[model samples]
Target: MPELIFRQPDGSTQLVSAENGSSVMQAAIRANVRGIEAECGGACACATCHVYIAPSDLLLIPAAKEEEEDMLDGVCAERREGSRLACQITVTDALGDMIIDIPDRQY
Candidate 1:
């Protein structure tokens, strides 16, 4: 398992263990983390799992594909350079202790 640190907009952090090969959204959902809805069930079909990659951990994750990029644009919160679809990030040792910030909303 890998560790995931989720940052809330108010500056608090929630740590959760992420199962290997599961998407970040799945990890959050399983942990009952409040920010990730994963409405599309890791299919990249929706933007409900939108998140912002912490710059320090950005390179540790994979680049987003075109479909994910398009989906991200629909995220309810304002987007940033680090915006990504959490459903696309599969956990791995390389992503250990990976940190991400949840947007204000997922709709």
Candidate 2:
């Protein structure tokens, strides 16, 4: 399992264990981490699970697909080079200690 660190908009952080092969959104939902609404339940249909991956961890995970990229256009937060949909990032050993920042609002 990999450990994920979520940095909330309020400057608080939630650390959770993510099972390999599971989506980051799934782990956040399981741990009840705030800021990740996951309205589409990891379907990549919505931007509610938007997160900013740490620049250092960017290469650890695969790049977002076209569908996820398209959905990101609707995110309420500013989209940066590190922005990614949590539902599109699968937990893997390569991502041993990933850190993501949640926006202030998803809606």
Q: TM-scores of all models?
A: 0.94, 0.95
lDDT of 2: 0.90
Each prediction's whole-model lDDT (CA): 0.87, 0.90
Q: Which prediction has the highest TM-score against the true structure?
A: 2
- The local distance difference test score of model 1 is 0.87
State each candidate's clash count.
0, 0
Clashes of 2: 0
The residue-level lDDT of candidate 2 at 100 comes to 84
Error of 1 at 30 (Å): 0.2
* Residues 1-107 of candidate 2: C-alpha lDDT, one tens digit per residue: 78888989888988899999999999999999998999989888889999999888898888888998899998998988899999999899887667789988898
- Tens-digit lDDT track of model 1 for 19-73: 8998889989998888888877888898999999977777888788999988977
